[model samples]
Target: MNPLHRVGLATARHPWRTIAAWILVLVALGGLAATLGGELRDNWNVPDTRAQHGVDQLREHFPDAGGSSAQVVLHDDARLDAAVVDEVVAELEGSEHVTTVTPRLSEDGDTALLYVRYDVPTTDTDIYGIVDPLWEAAEPAEEAGYQVELGGELPGTATEIEGRGELIGILVALALLVIAFGSVVAAGLPIAVAVGGLVAGSSGVMLLAGLMDVSTSAPTIATMVGLGVGIDYALLIVTRHVARLRAGDTPVEAAARATATAGRSVVGAGLTVLVSLMGLRLAGLPTYDAFGFATAISVVCVMAAALTLVPALCALAGRRLMPRKVRRLDTSSPSGSDYSTTERGSSTTDDTWTARWVATVARKPVAWALVALTVLLALGAPALGMRTWPQDGGSDPKDSTTRAAYDLITDEFGPGANGPITLVADLDEVSPGEVEALHREVADLDEVASSTPVSTSPDGRLAVWDIEPTTSPIDEDTTVFLDELRADVLPDGVEATGYTPILGDISELLQERLWLVVGFVVLVSIVLLTVMFRSIVVPLKAAAMNLLSIAAAYGVLTLVFQHGWGSALLGVDHAIPVSSWVPILMFAVLFGLSMDYEVFLLSAVRDDWLDTGDAKGSVVRGIASTGRVISVAAAIMVAVFLGFATESAVVVKMLGVGLAVAVALDATVVRMILVPATMTLLGKWNWWLPGRSSAARQLDDELDVTPTPTH
Candidate 1:
């Protein structure tokens, strides 16, 4: 029996059994949630390539130096009185984590900046723990007649990471559901299913994070996507089932039929999405690996809920779930078709558009294929010259008083007033003269804007230097300059260690791994497609189509976000180097999502082809039948993603908007027009395989052999 048809038969025969099974599953899931707690981390640890070079310079020069520090800004009155400054300084010094506190005046005399040095390590979680106390101190300072503001890495990260933003996300989701479904009850049901999935999925992530060094960012994104998508898929299935019931089909009959059709589509779509997410593991970046695994797990959980829990809910609600009274009023006396009669005849095959379109496609395959290919090529043009950088310059300068103060300092004390690089050099048995020569060599590099003299360790075994780079620390160019220093400028005897060098090494590693990741994703996708379709030609064609979709998305990203062509309208100004990890991440995510719609459309076509033996009719019918569902799913996902884009963080915004655009384009252009056109051109070649002449025939037999319920 086909798995979907079997599900329908089982539900129809044993509705209570299905409901009982899901209830037990829900109980266990809830119990699991109670035992787990949310695990949170604040830092992204984006490897800074310049850290090593800066450490080398510091070690060769200033051995006694500490690592880089962040400045804490204190917002105060316009006058900048001496008492206020002294009071703030004293309060900072008395704080538990404080190592040193220095107060400085803005040139305009409107703000006082406090550079607070913490004794704790930058990587320590304790740094975030100090934020509340720091805020407490600032509050007293403000009461003492200064409008104090605490701004630094710790403060900024703490503020951003404080809550899950679940409430806001849920509220937004509800609003979108109401707009999409036009029923409060209908909108609420999907949210309930999604929340259940999210709760269960989040616990899974937390447990996984404990077992592996996963990126903290993964959970946040996974929950958002999982909840939104879970609700979307569930809504499609539930709505279809309810519509059937309202049309007068018995509750059991409606559930059976809906499960057989929409259930198959959901499973296909979910598997496609899951496979794509798993593809991210190929990127070779541990962070991306973590993201892939976490997201894949969540997707699986969502799929389970959509398949099981949603059906159970439908069975339990029975006919009451549909607004039957309202539906009856909406259907006037003129169209005297009784609900039961209408529903029985409303099988997916009854739609005339599906048959008519299939005939047209069967007649003109070549023309449609050419048109599809041309459209994809046009959309993919911008990706060819796409360039990426590290920093997405969308942060609010005003929000970070430290950044604001840094801006003021740059205006008054020159741009070099920003943090200096810490260079660490390990000395084995090298003489002072050799060390001095190495220092001179480094100091002469044009990229080294300025260098301070070396400071030796207490045992004279390590040396450190305070070297300032001409470019900003976060700038890609500065990392490149640091790379040149490490590879070309470093003397043979000295080994450098610091923030900059580590960042440089990470960048090089990422660059090297890019192709490997892409190859892995493509390889996996091809294999999965082959297994699903049992045909070499179909898999190859699907892979080609996916690549084109991804390339087009990348091209759009380059034009709008990277090139700053429409950045202003998007509320972003800084042209951030696309993060090194984004391309691989996008490839995995977009390919998977695109494949989702592909599978949903193709499954229907495949089914139809088996039943009628008409290739053209099947493709056209499949596209027409699945088109509405895919469009609705894509619309909900786009809205959810676009909501995330409103966040001030540039990376989140980029990811949100980028995914939104890709999903929208794939749903409308690729799935609706391009896919049908291409399929028309391929004809029987679409089912071709290298070694098997009768593969399509075999597939047809397999489809036909599957069990069907006796109506």
Candidate 2:
């Protein structure tokens, strides 16, 4: 027996032991994670960039003023309040991690900013903690008719979602599962297995956090992936086990066979996901590293749970997992001896609605293929004009302190004050007079609103200045302004880094490296697919189709978020660039997920081909056999991802929406209609692979050699 078969059999034979062991593991890991896991923080390590180099110097020479800073904006159009502003400064100085609070008044005299520097970097500190004191201190000003808001990273920071999205997703999955299986016991088993695996996987990621700089969004993103794939994996296993039991196999026997087939698919899908995510390491960002770790670990743990726990759960549930009409399983039937022939519980007849639909699509392969391609291409066309920027607080809701601060700053001081360029210079290398000359030159530029005089360090080896632009922080003009200044004006010794430069660098880097990432991911995935399915044509076609799916998702994101078409319905009021990291993230995630449907469909199709030797018939049969399960799985994924869409973070919402749209398209149009039509068109060529026997290879060669044929 294969490893998957052995695992399934082992778990099923000792169901209670398996369940107890899984629970023990979950509890132990949960306890350890809660007690010892490292804290989650936002760390964007864009090393070797101009901004990074400049920031490094500031940290070196001007430690007091160098680290991450926030501004406490006290604005009142009515007039000034000195006592209240001084109280705010005094209160800020007492907060934990606060190093120095430098107070400055705007030229308009109606606005005041207490530039509060923290000893720690923004990545390591709790932004809300910093704001808590500011918020409390600002009460006096607010009572005196002044608008008080926390500006900078404090207000715009994307905090972790409080599990509401995951809970909603799970509830939806439960409802759908009940509808799909028509058995509450069956519906709940998949959820149980998925949640158990998720707990273990999340705990593992928590442990991983101790050794790495985990991003705050890592857990939320990981949970999103875990719920979607975990539930889907369990659903596949449960579906197969039900079919096996109805075919008259004993519960234990059925569980083993289900694991061998569906469990194999789970492993393959998880590996593809992992492999695609491995390309994220190529992006060379520490945040991606943490994200990859969290998500990859979730896949591994959930896959293991599906492979092991699902069978045990199935054995425990027994006949109840079967539909109500078929609950009385007869294990004495002769067909029960053979697992391969009992692919699904029911026989597929030409009269069935699903079968008729498959045949209808199969008959006109070219037309269906063209229509599917046209729709996918049209949906993805908007991606070509996508504009990418890093997440900004300025886009937040007006009620948020960050946005309020942004508006107040823009109104009183100018749009440029919201995001000022920080210039750092080594005073030892270039004299203070030269620094002043550079500032004057910069101030005279069209983009410049004003440039502050350089603030030299106590030792006189370093100087830093705040340069305000005339444009808003999120404005494309600000990005252009920064780039032009960097390339033409800023000398080697002088370095510049701030919101605009940092956004420009991240966007430029990700955009430039996007092709390399795509090439590596696609090439590796194709190789893996070829090895698994033993068909060059199948793997190549799958790759192309998955690319289409990803592109379509990008198009939807561009149209909704970037173009601001219907964005207001999603809580965003105006146009904003797609988060720079989101595209690469979507590519890695969607490619693997889309391939899942491909894997399941191809596996079933190849099985029918080996049995009946009729390519067209096999394509139709494959769809008839796997189409319902694929649709249900994709629907679950879509609902789960959409649940995450309710999150307030721009990046999180973008990811949720993109994943949902792509999966919706992939499972419906691409997998059901497009793949079947293409298979029908290709005929026997679909199974063509070199250096292989006519007989099927075992799953992963490890590849399943046994043909899983259905009646």
Q: Which candidate ranks first by TM-score, i.e. highest?
A: 2
Error (Å) of candidate 2 at residue 370 is 1.6
Q: Which stretches of candidate 1 lie over 4 Å from their true place?
A: 1-38, 42-69, 74-123, 136-152, 159-187, 239-249, 320-375, 392-394, 397-406, 413-419, 429-431, 440-446, 492-508, 699-711
Candidates' C-alpha lDDT: 0.64, 0.82
C-alpha positional error of residue 365 in candidate 2 after TM-score superposition, expressed in Å: 1.8
Q: Which residues of candidate 2, in runs, are more than 4 Å off?
A: 106-109, 125-130, 143-145, 328-351, 428-431, 691-711
